[model samples]
Target: MTKKVRSVRPDTSFKETALALIQNRLSGVPVVDRQGRLVGIVSESDLLPREALDDDLLASAQAFFEGTFDWDSLFKNRKAVALTAGELMTTPVQTATPHTLLRQVAKRLSESGLRVLPVVDHGKVVGMVTRHDVLKVYCASDADTLCNVKDALEHRGYVPPRHCIDASVHEGIVTLGGTTIDPEGLRRALALVRAMDGVVAIRNLVRVDSSAG
Candidate 1:
């Protein structure tokens, strides 16, 4: 997720939004309220000359309007806005949470046909997750995944002793094996691993350390 997100105000004019998108080379941007809460999203698609937009918007707007688009996947938020971004932007947009797994993000994008998904926390935009961002996980090597898994377990206080736990990755499939005296810790550990961005699957072979009582 991109924490430093670019956004627009609801009152922004069409031309202003278009120029910002063009100069920044942004395909789309989120619409934020006074408190920076996500109200809607504006993508290149919003600028396109649909039956809704006038002819003058074709060239400059085309580079944007005809070019890129962003908004709710179902267009349920679609309304008629001639010149302002407030009415033009799409609303009720699909979103993801900070803890959302990359796999889940990928699935949402694929199912919804959205170019970007906003990361929202408590009605505020925290970050932006693009298709490119989700795809980057596939580029990660197994070594990287193992390192992350190890790092995660180390930071967790609920997990078993780090030295007693073993993790191995093969082609992004992670296997966890060891003995843990804390059943709850093992449960948490498995959940942490399952959410890793690069993890394709998780196989747990850990046993309970019954002797530790």
Candidate 2:
């Protein structure tokens, strides 16, 4: 489980809390109380009903040129609706105890369509679980095996575009990163990496240069 957790207070404004979720690109935020106990879960679905406009929402998203977001105007015009985390959150939240089995947690989250799960211990929020963390656990195989795989790839025609390309193997999972390329290249590279022995996954930070520069 990852140490990083995103949380909000029950009294937090709906707009403010939703903005925080967007800022983090998180599917949901844990609603905590004064003592940091998990009370509810707030997700994007909770914000969608308000017809709120995000800070980066463009009139025409495809067009590169757009006016700056006037937050003050948005607020004054009541474009920003007032909501509290408590009013918008989902109660009886599905949760996992700290000692809950990983497979169980994965299954529950998968079936429920929840992107993140709050790790609770003694009825208090302690950590969080996301799909990425679950995948990372299975993808990192072992250090030496990952290094050998990287070496084999380098020997083969696959190139690591940046100094950041790294490999890790733990429990037969492989993670690769530190490369930059277009989406097609990334897909090809990751496919090749997955072809290696004991490579169960690849964590890619490969950036695509979309500019015509």
Candidate 3:
């Protein structure tokens, strides 16, 4: 999650929001209160049409048949008009919590067709998560994943000679081999590997020894 996020206040003008988005190269910005709680979100799509224009009425069958449409004129008019972020932003914003799992966050973004999600904690805005952020998990290098897994195992005292666990990573998948006298230790090691960043899957080829202590 990106802890430092660019945002707007409810009363921020639409022109300012658009300028900020263009400057920051972002598609949208979260609307927060003075106390920093997410209230809504403003995107380029929301600001495309004139806020004062009644889109539902203008797009009606009768209006369309009348041939009174002028796309360029309408788009230009919207930009010429000044509106506040609260007037143009979308409400009931979707968000993620700090404790939310990465997979779950990815699912939410996918289902909502949104490129960014605000990370909230205790009803306050904390950070931002983008589609790029989640994609990085799958793009992790095999060598880095292997090193991370090894470090995690070593931290838990589950490395070779101590627990007889051998690890190798290929294409983001980790394969564990060798012999372990303790079944629970093997389970813990597998769990660690599964939780490691960039690990696509796990192949547990470990041979468990029940008699050896």
Candidate 4:
């Protein structure tokens, strides 16, 4: 998730929002209140249909079909007029929490067809997660995931002789096998591997030795 997010206020004008999107090179931005709570989101698709009415391309197309253009009626159309973010933004926005699992985040983005999802905590926007962010996890190599898991266990002092944990990765699923003298160390190792990116699941074949301390 991107900690720094580009957002706009509800009262911000459509022109300003469009300019912000252009300057930031974003397709959409979340609408927030003065307190920085996400209320809605506005996108280029929301504005493009209205903005297209004023474009030369639209005029040319209209001219090709009709003998004359109704300039006065076009100008009078409410959609042609610049509105505010509050008027244009879609509400009841879908969001994700910081603790949300990567698989769930990916599922939501796929089902909703949303490019970005605001990460919220305690009812306030904390960061933003994009499809690219989720994709990075899925794209991680199995070897990389296994190496990271082993490194994490070693860092936590779950090593051979004292705490033996061997890991094997096949298509992103990790199978942990061996013996652990310390149950706490085994738990920590499992937790570390489970939390790792690209780890689809874990198979725990480790036998815990409660006698050894």
Candidate 5:
């Protein structure tokens, strides 16, 4: 999630809104009211319904030779028909909160087809999360996950030593095989690995047997 959320006011003109998206390299911007309440959202998709004159594109060569290319005017005509952010923005905007789980945000972004989801606090935008942000967390390699798991165990100072533990990772799945008399230790280890990034599943073959090493 980003700490600084860029937004546009409801009365903001379409030209200003387009500049904001272009200058910031953002696909969308949240619309906020005077009281800082999220009223709607504007996205590139929302602005695509109104297209530019095809004749302008066809005359590109002629315009170039005549030095009559007015990009500002041409793009202005291409912008969405609605002149204000309020008119062009989509209402009932999809959003997340500071407390929303990362998985939930990922799910929303995936299923809802949103490029950027605003993170709100009591209807006011505080931050934003993008699909790229979620990808960064979940895209770790299997080797990295394995290394992270081993490091976690080492930092905890395992009592019986790590030699007795058999751990291997494949496709983000962790397989645990060892003998542990302490169920609490097994539980703790499993929980630790499960919470780790890129760990998709765990095969717990650890046995709680006093006679086993």
Candidate 6:
């Protein structure tokens, strides 16, 4: 299952938005319109402080501060609080579909240097995808783990008992059945399943081979 989404409106003030992000411990916020359409996103990178001053201004300010400039008066003359979301927001945002596989999404996030991706549906924004969400959901989501296990076993000289041993995956559970050489072989097969990634459980019914010629 995926996570629920939280978003903010485009008209939200940068001051308020920054405060919200800080309070939630979030790196950024998705900016949406009144119809819930994704307009842009604002991140900490967007809120970077501007250059302290131009060359001439910096020299004068440095000389004054070193000499007799009052800290309170000079600070009051500076303007840093005027930044806004509209001025700092990143536009033409990248997005992800909800049905997108988590592995692919994680790769996109890493390659794009983006911490979050807005989840869209039919060109409309529906939710958001964050790095944390990608890690939690994709790491836990079921993949072709059973196939991996079977392939590993085949590579490790663990030959299945002819047509006796079979393997399959369903809903993160690895199902192993059919006869093997002995109880130890069956245990080895189960261990293969256990070692696989994304395998939530193993259902083993492989009987110990006791066939008599």
User: Which model scores highest in TM-score?
Assistant: 3
**Candidate 5 Cα outliers beyond 4 Å, as residue runs:** 52-80, 139-171, 179-196, 207-213
TM-scores of the models, in the order given: 0.61, 0.51, 0.73, 0.61, 0.65, 0.51
Q: How many pairs of residues collide in model 3? A: 0
> After superposing candidate 4, which stretches have Cα over 4 Å from the reference?
54-82, 148-167, 170-196, 200-213
Tens-place lDDT per residue, model 1, 1-213, is 777766789899888888866754556778899998998888788777445445433434555566564334225324434477787787788889998877889998898777888899999988788898887986799999999988888888534444367889998999998787878878888998898888899988998886967
State which candidate, 2 or 6, has the greater lDDT: 2
lDDT of 4 by residue, 1-213 (tens): 777667889889988888876764556678899988889977767787675665855775677588786666554454445488887777788889999988788888898777878888987878878888887886788889888888877788776645777889998899999887777778888887887778889999999877765
Pairs that collide, model 6: none
The lDDT of model 6 is: 0.66
Give the backbone clash total of model 2.
Answer: 11
Worst 10 contiguous positions by lDDT, candidate 6: 73-82
Stretches > 4 Å off in candidate 6: 1-5, 50-82, 137-213
Worst 10-residue lDDT window, candidate 5: 157-166
lDDT of 6 by residue, 1-213 (tens): 224545667667767767755654556667777877888777766654434436536765787978965667545434334255655567878778977876667777898788878778876666667788765632543445655767777775455544367777777787777776666666776786675556768888776767731
Q: Model 5 compared with the native: what TM-score?
A: 0.65
Kindly provide the TM-score of model 6 when superposed on the true structure, using C-alpha atoms: 0.51
- Clashing pairs for predicted structure model 3, backbone only: none
By lDDT, the better pick of 1 and 2 is 1
For each candidate in turn, give its C-alpha RMSD to the true structure in angstroms: 8.2, 15.9, 5.6, 7.4, 8.9, 10.5
TM-score of 3: 0.73
- Among the numbered candidates, top lDDT falls to 3
Per-residue lDDT for 1-213 in model 3, tens only? 777667888788877888866764666788889988899887777777655456544564455598866666655455435488887677888899998888888889899888888889998878878888888998878888998999999899887768888899999989998898988988988987887668899999999987886
For candidate 5, write residues 131-196 as lDDT tens digits. 888778657888898888888877864324743556789888989887777777788888888877
Scored against the true structure, residue 17 in model 5 reaches a CA lDDT of: 84
